[model samples]
Target: MPSPDPKIISGNANQPLAQAISRRMSMHRGVKVGLVDARVEVFNDQEIFVEVFENVRGEDMFIVQSTSNPANDNLMELLIISDALRRSSASRITAVIPYFGYARQDRRTKARTPISAKLVANLIANSGIERVLTMDLHAAQIQGFFDIPVDNLYASPIFALDLMHHFQGQMDDVMIVSPDVGGVARARELAQRIKAPLSIVDKRREKAGEVAEMTVIGDVTGKKCIIVDDICDTAGTLCKAAEVLIDAGASEVHAYITHGVLSGPAVDRITKSKLKSLVITDTIEPTQAVKDCANIRIVPTAPMFTQAILNIWNGTSVSSLFDTQTLEPIYEPLYPGLAIDA
Candidate 1:
């Protein structure tokens, strides 16, 4: 017989997303799959603790936690929750991490620095987590760091639909620009999906979190350019790239980033930048500043993830969630009027 409907649990990282996924699951299975009763607390000394109130014996479990800002606390919550479930006799545990923090540190560029992403992978795999599900990992190679199954979902289809809806009949005027040479693959994928030309921003990062000089590789003159990247922390590179693109004669600039790690002056910089608009997914929950920004809009990823979770539980091909021929997400229509901001 097929396995029972999986139990959904969550840490404090992204409860809204976990709730959204649970609601979607209920609608899909024609039965409610409420979030498992659990509590994650931090003590006076900042020690993390997790307790699952439900009897999860022999039940498939999925824990949703994004290692976003306050990365250490959230990571600890995930690890602790997994340990609790394992001790409680849960048959399986899957870590549904929407935003995998420390992913940028997949390698060491200097001496004596740790490959933090690999270390994180080691922690998750060793924490009684049999599988991992996440979105648009910064470095694809990080998948190999896990000994267990890792499902790295893409936000490309989500961005593609929004792009098609926004650009509509004017796709010919659109140009997808990578903020840096490293992101060309990501930008090019979106460009290919929408049938737009691609351009690269050759940037030289003088130091961590700072971009020095940049040159646009392809012609963006008079084209409505869309810059794409995985993360947008501090917004320095994004703002600078927009300035250079506009100076190079682009009619207007917009951005469609997957993870909105708008930290430390990121919102302030985007507010006063040359870009017309910035669209990001809800992989990382939006803060008050992000919600209040007029030019920054959020697209939901819950529906896509809901389908992926179901596919995994049912032993089906999760790759079929996106149609290779059309590059559109192939799933049941999401609830009408799902709110964008939470």
Candidate 2:
């Protein structure tokens, strides 16, 4: 006999992504998801009002919402939805956030600064979320912030497949470039899979979202560079790195970032930069400005997340889902002894 289907529900954060996930789940036997009419309004005083329209009694409910634009409002909606599921006698609740906000504030850089990522984690746990499913968090350590089980998925496998399919013969001339030292692990993973040389752009930021200077840390000269990173909010560092790479004799430059949080003048900057293309995942909804940018291209992650959710539901291992070219792990055991097949 097959296992019972988990009830997947969604809020107003990113309905399209939720629906895509639902459609993928429905393709399998005995699996289905319903959307709760979680509409919200702001009072004249700017207070949030949320309503959950579906019954979740005794069901394994999964609430899908990405705290993207208007982060506070979306976050409140997720909390309210989770609370409703809990009150309705739902067996379990999983918060599926494609793009988790406040992740950039994981640690305190200066004194007295709040660790907002931990605060957000606490909020989700207090809101009755039993587990969390998100992608490419800005800081991997933010997973420790949450008390509940958290599954941090990677976009490298998806990106690697796309690169191989499109640029198979060009791998020899291609170089995987990390925009900074912090992203070396992510870039190295992609580099090993594609069998390309690895490079790094040593960037100095005088202030937030501002790149003061850049130094190429590897032999990028005469190479077609692909800069990889987790997030691209303002695109300042990426643009500066592309310029520096070109100045260092790079033949071409491209970027493949996981989350495209193209805020402020990011689209304008990327459109004018030396980057040949800027590929990103659909973790966050893209704006008209981002869609209109000629250099931007989106590679869908629906298939990848779809497989992961199915594996989790069917008691299968998810490690093989990410194992490309048999490379070693870069993360330091976020959940030790917790087998994916369990």
Candidate 3:
């Protein structure tokens, strides 16, 4: 017997991204995923009304809604959509979020502060989402908050490919640098794949939107630097780290961040920073400010994501999807160096 066609529905948050994914799937036979027009309106007193205008009975449903900017509205839309699919008897519902907002509020900094990440997880679970398919979460541990299975996809493979393609044959001179110590693991993974040395920026965050100090922790002198991180919110840390790298005698500095949650004056800062270019995935739709920035470039991940969705539907191992020629290693350096000496 053939498997049932999975339905792909998207909310107002990111219809374009959903459309791209749907178009990619169309290339493969026996795949049928369509988007549902999710029109939302505000009644009196700021109440939200979401209507999913398609039948989904007995079908596997995937709702693509990134809880990005206008986070509450997008999040609410996802919840209501999931609830609608559940009431309509969908066999399963998966929330495909490319950029998960309120992820920074995963923990409480002060007394009485709410752990909104956990709350959001509970809300999605209670709203009848059977699984979650997200990429490069601001906090990886956010997966622990969800009782349902969560597939956290990495943008590293995509970024690595782009970097290799752009650099061509200069991978040996490039070094992957984590903007801060917290992101060493993420940076190390990219470094290992590119066969480049690893470096780290030891930064102290005095407060939100501010980097108190930045200290380079590896041999970056005369080497090109690539800073890797999950999200680039204000571009504060990235800008500061680039300055530190330049001061440390690094020839050039670049950045590859997953979610370009470029809020406030992030674009302006990047445009004026010492960093040559800032590469980001289209996890969140780039604001006009980001698009206008000459130093910013976006790499699409639709193909990667589309394949993963298909793999999940067909009971295939999505892990092997990362090991492909499109994602093949470009650099093989003679020396393997660590950012920090243990």
**Candidate-wise lDDT, in order:** 0.88, 0.80, 0.83
Candidate 1: clashing pairs of residues? none
Give one digit per residue, the lDDT tens place, for model 2 in 1-342: 212676677777777788877776776544454455566666798776766666667777778889998899889989988887888788788888989999999999999999999999999999888988888889889989988888888888767766765565687889999999999999999898778899999888798756788899988889999999998988888899999999999999999999999999899999999999999988888888888889999876665666666666666776666764321221113222322111
lDDT of 1 by residue, 3-39 (tens): 4788999999888999999998998899999999988
In model 3, pairs of residues that clash are: none
Best TM-score among the predictions, by candidate number: 1
Backbone clashes under 3 angstroms, per model: 0, 0, 0
- Model 1 scores a C-alpha lDDT of 0.88
Output the better candidate (1/3) by lDDT.
Answer: 1
**Candidate 1 to truth, TM:** 0.94
Q: What does the lDDT come to for candidate 2?
A: 0.80
TM-score of each: 0.94, 0.90, 0.91
Q: How far in Å is the alpha carbon of 167 misplaced in model 3? A: 0.8
